[model samples]
Target chain A: MHRVRLGIVGCGIAARELHFPALVQLTDKFEITAVTSRRRERAEDFASMVKDALGYEPAVFDSYEELLESGSVDAVDLTLPIELNVPFIFKAVEKGVHVICEKPISTDIENGKKVVELSTNTDKVIYIAENYRHDFRFNKIRAFIDENTIGRPIFVAWHLWIGMDKSNKYVQTEWRQRPKHIGGFLSDGGVHHIAALRVIFGDIAWVSGVTKRVSDYLGDDDTLSTVFEFNSGVVGNYTVSYAVSGKQYFEIVGTDGRIYLDEERITVRGQREETINIPNQNTFKNEFEDFYRVVKHGEPNILGHPVDALKDLSFFEAAIKSKDTRIEIEDLLRSTTPD
Target chain B: MHRVRLGIVGCGIAARELHFPALVQLTDKFEITAVTSRRRERAEDFASMVKDALGYEPAVFDSYEELLESGSVDAVDLTLPIELNVPFIFKAVEKGVHVICEKPISTDIENGKKVVELSTNTDKVIYIAENYRHDFRFNKIRAFIDENTIGRPIFVAWHLWIGMDKSNKYVQTEWRQRPKHIGGFLSDGGVHHIAALRVIFGDIAWVSGVTKRVSDYLGDDDTLSTVFEFNSGVVGNYTVSYAVSGKQYFEIVGTDGRIYLDEERITVRGQREETINIPNQNTFKNEFEDFYRVVKHGEPNILGHPVDALKDLSFFEAAIKSKDTRIEIEDLLRSTTPD
Candidate 1:
């Protein structure tokens, strides 16, 4: 079996901290062949780091197009800012290269649908790197729900409250400070939460939400309180705030029992109580492995499909727009999907 | 201080288990002089218990009307079922007796408003015993919010998930099994949550909610997920479930800090973290003391006001009824208030 040659796009903190560490562990399935960034020095630094980890020096391209057209790589790993995702995804897929782009597919529904439409016109996999979908704890939770371990999930309450101060690396980014997207961090970090919910409860059917700007630095809306009704007959309250720090937990309550998830623990309360300490998982690595398998082994695309990321974008956009009325997720998609 | 002569109505579990024990502690402030129940034996048993505690035997009346008219009490403590609350309240107030009734004031908005109207026509205090208002933990929370301990309040998430099984005394009652009111236990027990929120914030400006029947035994709708917008510019998600047992916690997130409340503790995270061990106070006793002061000492009514309880009922009803649309709490109140 031959390894899939990969190029890294956008050599910012996510590329350096998250993706590079993950790529180091997948030397057998994936190899870093080329890299590109707006800042050529950062791309050079990334290439050097890749050589340090993989014992090879890859070409550093001046632009994403150069990386896509040079044929030095079979696929490109996109870690670009949110707004740049669509054009790069389209370029990679149209250029006949498998691509795993960072979430979301796009910041809004229209561009997300456009990317989805473009993916179907080709055989090259347009995988999305929504790492939350690959996180093992949610898989454990999904298995619990699938096995009736909690006696049918009736309700869910998920809260993500963290203070994104100046010291935080993500908070220091220019795009995040003045987000060009609809809901700022709500679309950026919030999509991961949506992806996790989709993994555990299926697609969201409808949503009603209220957004607040508790912190001026977090952009348009730093806080969102939303009620989502899933197609699987489960309703949940999901609130995400980048404004102030508080408890971060996701709880699912069922007829006979309840399941709770925090950052590092899973507590299941049924006839007997069980608390599982969730081990640290490199989610980016897991997603990359899935992307590699889908591209190389012709494995089925479940976790990395662009459509799943599109749905996540749709839910977040609908939540931002749903102030006083409930927005049906399917209707939002139908309206936004290009003919 | 002269002990206010109090008549006990409806000798059910709440009256026997809750009010009786409280009355024992308040012998100097309130004297149980007359008792009446649908069951003559329960009323006689209550009188004997009062005699054993207060060192005097009180008259046992065959009917609430007889007890009111016999001049055996200056104020009546009504511990009847939900449907009986409005009528008994009207009878006692019209008979010129100050009454402390169990929440809610009524099952529906129309009846609740009628009781509110009847209270305005006389000087006899119509106190609604919503013990959550008297619960000191909420007062501590209210103080924290008022002191800006958490800065300007941004959001709140309150979850109440408890199983009402056969062994639970309240679940064994015939009325609870076959509830005639709207939302059943939602209004029966959910009003306390609304009361706690009102105490912390202010009046709920509007509400959007979805209710589910997770347990067949808990009544029409055993689960509720609601987004409440307070008039004071705070928005919150308050979900209550009587179908399953999970964590019962109320969290308030503000611009500067956050306050967390569980069943046994209050955790405040701000410039300095504070964990308050919430000592148990007999909330019933606290409310009785307030009732005694209001009836005998001409003290102001705040905690036990009937209007406050009516608001609790209205909020719960609106949440239950607001399925596809948002319900403005003030509009609901205005529509129900009789001219």
Candidate 2:
């Protein structure tokens, strides 16, 4: 019956398009108590929008620390750009505030390890908002696999290709094109597939990959091909390309059948083929609802726990290292010391 | 229409399971005039089965050369073990007989090139029987791509895994376990996927691969992971493993949509997703029918030509070389010289 007061950092596209809409929809469960942005004008504009949209007024801050220090807020949603986001997560955790941070979790292993270490000492929850797992279509794929509809997955092939809107001014201004800011495509985008793979195939033991810069205009790579060996002994290959021109699709191949998920539907094929139309469930809304349920009831398995986030961060770090050194990622995962 | 008289060499599982049954069903278009095997009893048994199955009598030969020299057969179906099959194909082409050899076409570059050269001089057709292209589901995928349902393909990820059958008598055989006989797993089983890739994504310009023999008892590799770059700038990652305990499946990812095909059906996903139930059309039967059509009428553009077979053979050869030297495969189509 009690509502959790929330603070949101980063008033960018993700916050504007996903978090704002989701927070407005889950009004009964969560109250948007505070908002912050690097730019004070944007923060004021967002606060006004939230006031008009959700019918409540909350404190607005020009900095994340101000929002974290605000006594009215229960949790912080760190949707800030990666370079700022990593340090912000550590600060929020140290302040004894539960944090739900956007993914990659941290762009590199050192910072990621620090976040993991910080979570162990803190009673406040640290959850990574990896919405792909919460996305109902992908959840159905995991469900079908667990129910033995596919009868023990032996191979998983994922293809994610999202075209950039060249005409969008916001995209042109974003830090996504810079390796220093985003850790390149594999770290930012590939982490989703890696996290999804972990959820579907279990622990990944080793990986090998090649990253290539397709266009001279971008300093970082837009394409990647990676192979992963799961602890279950199943091998998976993933192809991620920002240069590719279309929608996303994925397939999970198992002993008895296969499950194919795309933009619009999910299909399971075995002794008989069945196609299921997935109704448009706003994944961001679902993710926030799950987060709300977990926080309200002390449920540990909602959204993705800190440990799950750490694993995905580890894999992302490993992929970047493998690409950089041109060494098999198996070496990185098995190494006793940091590369 | 004049029926094409056919002779089958090797009388092995391929002949018994695929070729013989296909010939029986298409009796109006094909006539089985002779059969041969290394063992006289096996040859006699096949000849009897062909006669009983089609209600037509065919001569039995103890030696392959005897069948080739018989002068009664118009074409030779080389369905023997891959090693014997390669040499038989060369001899068949030398005898000016059209050939439909079960794949790999030949295990090594030297023999495969020889078959290609022999085909150029003789007016007889040489089809490698790459049945996956003829597979109804793949054809549907091709149609979807042609229709621009998925738009232009930018990346393709294929997973082909066949579990080693413990009870399979063929595994007990010696040649299959030896690298020289079948060129290991990449050349033996992987050729099918590689050939399929060529059919979907143009000619491969280069490839980099890692191969591993997971089972200590097996002399040949059970797993192979490869990345190929096609001439059209489309890049692909392929994983072919006999070590994985599961079924076979593949997907073609394009800019606008995707087509995923497995054992049971084909699913095309674009702005929307639709699953097309493939009624278990026998790929071998369809392949033979195409071969029958090519022989009776003429080679059509879509139903694979001799050049396509040669290109597939070249890619297989390059994959083997790349695996052995740990080098990237380059310029397969241009080189007439064998490695």
Candidate 3:
């Protein structure tokens, strides 16, 4: 199979720490032939980092439009901020370039719907880069439930709390300090977790939650706790915050068994019990391969299409609304649009 | 310490398994001088069990009223079912016997309020048996937060899921099979957990939750998930069910650290990460001792007076109401009366 030539857009933390390293590992699947950033120095630095890692310096573009015009790659990995990424998808689609955008295709339903519409019309693939869906533990857990290793799934609970002082260094950036959108603290990270649930369980039929930013130091609401009802009759809970002590894990309560995952470990407790340290694989590698299947094999988008991705945003949308309206989650999420 | 004589009323599972043994442990501070049960056979069996366990045979009364009239003890441990317990509380209080009744002073706010008012007017101590307050790990966790070892508390999350099929033997009985009151699924157990949080954290000022009885076999609303706002400005989440996998624990998220407790284990993660296996002690022993302090030394009830226990009910009361009315928890719980 021919390598899928790719353009890495935005030399931000996500791109540097996540996608770049994954690209280095997927040398057989992806050729990162072009790169772009708003600042020339950032792009040059990313290129040098790539050279140090992969022993190659690919083309660098002053602007994303220039990269698209150069015809250096077949697909663009849009790693820019939420507001900036949607329009780039339109540009990539207009140029007939397949696109792999980060989670939450858009902050609002209107634009999110537009992305769905665009992807529907194009033969080129539009895959939302949802790495959690590709994680081995999540997949194994999902498979376990399907195989009746846990009987019928009943409840799902995921909780996380990490203080800003102890959070990722990117949390210190100016743009991130003030989220321009709804989900708050773990805004996009919220989308990622929701994606994981959708992958492991099924579509969320309803959701009820509360969101808060008790600290003035934070620009966006940094705390959220939500209860989710799956279309398959499973009830799930998720709580995340950037203003409390750190905890990162989730538990799925099933009829015949139970499963717990903390990214690094998978625990299944039921008629029998087993705890295994999950073997790590570059999730980005799995995400990109899935995208390639959609492009080359004419395979369906397995991670999530733009529409399925809306449910993740849908949960937090209702969460923000619930904080003010005090409305029941089922009522809030009853309408398809997560407005 | 002068031993405080006690008359135990009701020979049910809880009274027999819990309080009877607890009374034996606090023999230095108290003695089970008399006992009563509706069925003479049950009372006789308890007397024999007490003889075997504590090496003493207490007097047995055919009726609680007879035990009260005889003045065989200073206080009575009321352990009847929820509906029956309130009137007996009144009977015990009116008879001028100090009382150590069970948690959830009453199911309905009207009766619950009456218990509170009666306790207020009397000089005799009325201590609700909230054993969680006496739990070693729970108290230690609370003390850690008070000492600023975990900084200011920000969030609390407790979740439990136990399938009805695998639940306690009492679940097989008629009344439990069809809950007679609010706080669906395991109502008494629900009240117990809420009581535990009140012990470990603080009074839940406002609570918002969604509870459902997705299963038919369970008598009460077999599932509950609630978010609580403490008067201290801390937010907590609790998800519990008797229709799913079994888990029982809570997490206290503070600014500097976090504490996770699952009955037998206490995990503190923060500037330092520590997971300690806490040896389980008889929580009921500490509970009775605290009551002994109240009656023997005129100390104020530390875990809660009747009025304080009402707040725990008020949370579930609102929880039950939230299902149909779609009312905000803060609004539903704003008034002292759970209307």
Candidate 4:
């Protein structure tokens, strides 16, 4: 098996905390050849962190195009700010380099559409790094619904509420605190949960929401409570808050029973209460490895396809739209389980 | 304090199961004088049931007019079908007797406005039997919020999903199966949770919803997912279904913490998750005793005010209207705490 030489774009926070550790676990499948960031020292620091974590030093590029022209990379791992993805993705595809970009390909639908369209037109494969879809606990619950463990799913509730203070790391990032993208916290963090819903329940058909700015530091909607109708014909309710302290929880109700996911512990209440199995999974590694398989052996894309990622992005885009328009977003029967 | 002699109307299912037992518990504050039903046998059965539950027999009336005109009652507890309340309430008030009718006063805003108007015109007091307002667990949570145990109440979510099978007792009733109310199951059961929100938060300023009939036997909207914006400046979301099996649960999320209410337990997630006290008090008895105090000592109504009940019903009416019109119901900033 040939190892795809990977160039890491955007050596920012996630590149250090998440992707580098995940890449170290897949030494057999991928070779980290180069890294890029506008801040050359952070780019060098990312290389040092990678070498410290795993005994290897990758080339560091101060500019994204320099890595593309260096021809030392066969694929690109994009972890840039959301709105910064389209041009890099377009350039990667034009260079015949396979690309794996972060969730929410773009913050807005127009830019997301361009990336999806251009990536589809090219032969180079593109994948979305939506780790929740790859997370084991979520997929296990999805299997329960799919296998009729809990009868047909009818309702879903997902709440993610956490306070943002000066001490918090994301609050220190300028792009997150006041993003050029429409929904700041909502787009950056909310995309994962919405992607989980899209992965589990098919696709969102329509949405209506009540979104507000509960935080002073956040420039856009920091709190959003939305009701969604899945294309599978189930109603799912979700509330995402970056200004409150109700950690996180997701519950799914079906005809036969209910699956309550309080953080990692899952309680399935059917004829009786049962604790379902929770497998140890590194979702970032799982996401990267799945992308590796698609690039290596051409394994059919399961939940990692960029089109599948676009569905959630579009739904979230619609959530912001619904908040702005003060109306339920209808006529949004986007393709489900993209082939 | 003088004990109010109370006439009980409508010897239906709830009359036998709920109110009679509650009346037994409040023997000192309320003296049962007469029981009425359209059917004489049911009325007699109710009197016998009350006698069995307590240690005395009350007079039986075949008609509401007989209960009102018999002069055997100073106040009446009307537990008739929801739409049956307005005329009976007017008759009770015309007789200069205090009346406490079952929520919502009426299913529609038009009939509800008439009841609220006529009750205000006369001097005799009118109360709506919104027992959930008197419910101990709900009130405990409310007090927690009011005392700043939880910070500012910013969001609320309530979900009730239960299948209505033929074996169910409520399914045996014709009114619930083919309800004349615009929101059938929503008005019948959803009003309770709605009232809980309206009481804890202030008056609802606006609402939007997606309602559907998930049950074939039920005539109106058996499923409803609604978002309410309170004039108190909070966003509340609710989803109720009579077609799935996730019993009933509601969570109130504040700026600092959250309080979760399942069927029998109350969990407050603040500084720590202590299953807050679930004091066992009969909501019906508390409702009746509150009305008794309001009537005898001229005490201020806590949750007994008809206008308060009217506010919940109107928000619900707007929910149904929002469903039918395919729009958000706005400009509904009715009175918060009624005079």
Candidate 5:
């Protein structure tokens, strides 16, 4: 098997903690040939760690432009800050390299479309690395619904309440604390939920939402309560808070039964109650595997499609900006279409 | 203790099953003086049941107007269909008798405002019996919120999914099966949830909502997903479906802790986790006790206030009619004012 040459574009926490750990396991599929970051020392540390694990020295570049110019890689794993996502995607694609960028292709719709247009006009694989689409738990939930184990789905209730305290590693990140994204952590991290919803229920047609800025530590709105109406005529409630005590679950109640997805189990309640124990699976690993297949084998990409990520961001943006009005998701997308 | 003379003006399911069972226990507070209904046989059956329990032979009247004219009761408990609620309140008040009418005050704003005006003008106690406001479980929840066990209030998520099967007695009822009320069962039964929300979170300021008509058995929209913004700037999500499998819960997540209220217990997660086992209390009995206090002792009526029920109905109506726009609760109330 020909190993795809990979470049680690960011030496931030996610790159070091999430990506590198997952990449080291897929040695046959990917070879880390280069690393780059704003901080050269972090990039050197990342390359040294990669070299020690895979027994191959990698080139370290001070800038993403330099990494692209060096020609040391076939594809770049872009995990930079939110504001830098689209700009770097354009640079990588312009340099004729396969690009797998992190979630939220950009902070807003205009830049997100630029990636869509760029990917449309190029053969270089431009995949948006949204892990939730690749997350196994949500996949099980989607299968359960499709199997009619719970009958036809009538409604859904998703509750996410996490206290993003200073002790939490994600909360300690400076950009998250004062986000340049549309709704701070609400958009920066909320896209995953939208992706999962779309994965299970298809596209949302409309959203009526309310938001609150609860914690000063978390910039923009930290809490959102929304009602989503899908094209299939199913309506659901989503309440997410970053300033509260923790409890998380996604429930889909249907005509014959209900399916509940939590961290530990998938509970099916109907004529015969059943519990499906969720095995521990690294979602980032799953995402990387799919990206590898899409790049190497020319496989059809669903999770990595830039349009899917764009739809997720568009839904997130519409929800937070709804301001107590029912926003049509298609209308928001339509307005963003280049004239 | 002087027992207040009470007339039962409806002998349908609620009057027969809920009121008689509850009133029999409050013999020291109320006396069964008369009974009336659209069906005379049901009224006779109810009177016999009352006499069997209380050792008092109550008059069986064929019409509510005759019961009002009999002058044998100081107050009447109105548990008729939703359409008859406001009209009968007017009849009882015109006869110079006090009333404990069933929720909601009326089906829409115009008639609802009439009750508000009449209750405001009347010297006699005209109490609207919205049992959820008097339910002991909700009282405990309110006390929990007021005690600040959950720290500063942040957000809430309320999920109610019940499969209204043909075997269910309420679903079998002709009125409920084909409700004359707006939004069908979504309004008739959904009022209780609104009452509980108001009791716990105070008056809601605005609502953005979506509705879905899922079941053919359910007359109108049987599923509603709504985002409520309270006057205090706290936001919440409420999704209710009468067409799906049963799973009910109201969760409030705050800074210091969280409160989970389900059928069995109030689970509090905080510094020191606690579980408050909810004792089964007949809410009808509690509501009758409050009404007795208001009529006999001339005490201030909180739960039994007609305007409170009106507000609950107004909020329900606004949410169902919101369509795709955000409805201001106070603006809805202000529009119903007697000009």
Candidate 6:
């Protein structure tokens, strides 16, 4: 199969840690044809790393539009912050390039909806890189639920807590803490949990939440507990805390059993309980490989299509409204917010 | 040690499934002196079960007050519905009997607080049966957190979902589904998660939530999700759903590690991730043994203390207020409703 030429639109941590490293490993699947960052020096630094490691150097563009119009790349990966990437996605779709964007496609619901509509009109595939769904351990649990190994799910509890080092250079520059840019933790981190739950359980019919900033560093709240009522009548409780001092874990409970996932293990129980060891394979590499396959073969990856991404985005928008108005979000389409 | 004569109020599921069986196992620590139920048939049936199994015929009462005044019992296990249990607890306290009541000590905050105050005034011990905290898996995780195996907790995602059978005769009779009597799902099922989180984290600073009813047969809502901010700046998200079709699971994420627990197993992850084989021991048996040890030998069992029970009840009250007002609850004392 011919390699899909890729242009990355952000040079931040996600770009450095995930995209760049992943592109290097899947050399036969993808080529980094062009790169852009707000700071030319940072982009150059990233380009140097790619050149030194992969023995290939891509052209650099200070402007995202310039990179898109160059016509050298077949696809664009929007790794930029939500505020900047929302517009970039529309432009990429307009240019007829297949796009893969990071989560919270846009901080605002209207803009997120627009991105979904644009993708639908252009026939360009828009994939939300929700890595949690792609993680092998979670995928296994999802399969288990489908197989009814645990029986019917009555309730589900998910915990995703990661302590962020504020002093880390990547976290310092990220737009996550800014409510205007990323819609706080509920929009930033909370979206991942919301999307994952929707993927595992089904559609969320209603949601309500409380959001708060426990840390002094972030202007917006970093902590939130959101409840989801599924269309199947399953009840779910999720606690998302940024202030917790620990690693990440996810668990799902069913009538006959329960399943749990972390970085290196999946434990499940019901009529009988068992724990499976999950080898700590680099999840980012696996995710990128799937994205490349989808781009190359028109294969449907587990992250779902652009419309599915939009549905997840819609839930994020509703969660914010639920937090602000203290009302249960019944209808995503009817749910409105300030621009 | 002389055997402590026990009187059980409410021959409900908890009494049958948990207390009665456990009492049988700890024959050396306890003797079933009497049993009470609103219905004469149930009281007689329970008395017969005890008599047939133990070969000791205990008295039966149609009312709890009669059981308390029988003078044949030293302690009362108040397993009545939350609404009925609160008044029964006060009556037991007035009779100078030690009390072990089931969770959510009261549906109303004011009543729960009064129970706390009344216990403080009397010499009688009031142990609330919060078995989740006593469960060995949670205790192991809590010890690891205390030891900093996971580092400082910056974020936490906790979820507990359990599927229930609507046709189950025991569940059908449960008062937990009625909002007027038990404060619904959030009050009944949710308090377990709330109380557990409070014990592991700290006092809840604020809470916001949404509640909904999925089942037509129940008067109370079947689904709920609530966000809590701890006074220590730790933010948490809690979700509970009665409509889910699966098993029960709980997970905790910390700075350096993560812990996952279900009925069958426990897994912890950090720099090194390990899944431990947790034996499927009946937790209620452990709870009863601990209570017996404390009552007979003056041994310190964490859940055997009255103050801890009161604290769990206080958190239950706070969660209900947070659910009702759709606001962050800062002062649990002020938000409590009178009994």
DockQ of every candidate structure = 0.14, 0.08, 0.12, 0.15, 0.24, 0.14
Interface Cα RMSD per model, in Å?
Answer: 16.8, 16.8, 14.1, 15.9, 16.4, 15.6
> Model 5, residue A199: what's the lDDT?
88
Question: lDDT by residue for model 5 over B53-84, one digit each (tens)?
Answer: 87878999989889998889999999887888
Query: Candidate 3, residues B212-305: lDDT per residue as tens digits?
Result: 7756777767888766666666777788877765667577877777778885788877667778899868989888878988898888786758
State which candidate has the highest lDDT: 1
| Docking quality tier of model 6 | incorrect
lDDT of 1 by residue, B1-339 (tens): 398998999999889999989989987888888999999999999888887877898899999989999988999989887899888988988799999998888877767777767777889999999899988988898988788787888889998887676678888788888887778888898888899888889888766678888776765778888876787769889988787776686788887888988878999887568999999799999989888888888988888887788778777766655565633222222233222
Give the per-residue lDDT digits (tens) of candidate 1, residues A235-275.
88998888777668688988768889987799988755789
TM per candidate: 0.88, 0.66, 0.81, 0.86, 0.91, 0.62
Q: What pairs collide in candidate 5?
A: none
**What is the C-alpha interface RMSD of model 4?**
15.9
Candidate 2 at residue A285, lDDT? 86
Point out the worst 10-residue segment of candidate 1 chain A by lDDT: A329-338
Worst 10 residues of 1 chain B by lDDT: B329-338
Q: What is the lDDT of residue A230 in candidate 1?
A: 84
Candidate 3: fraction of native contacts reproduced: 0.10
Of 1 and 4, the candidate ahead on DockQ is 4
- Highest TM-score against the true fold, candidate: 5
Report the number of clashing residue pairs per model.
Answer: 0, 1, 4, 0, 0, 59
TM-score of chain A of each: 0.93, 0.89, 0.90, 0.92, 0.93, 0.88
Candidate 4 residue spans exceeding 4 A from truth:
A47-59, A271-277, A296-302, A324-339, B1-6, B22-35, B47-62, B65-74, B94-97, B161-165, B212-221, B243-248, B262-276, B296-302, B324-339
Docking verdict class for candidate 5: acceptable
TM-score of chain B of each: 0.93, 0.87, 0.89, 0.90, 0.93, 0.86
Clashing residue pairs, backbone N/CA/C < 3 A, model 2 = A246-B255
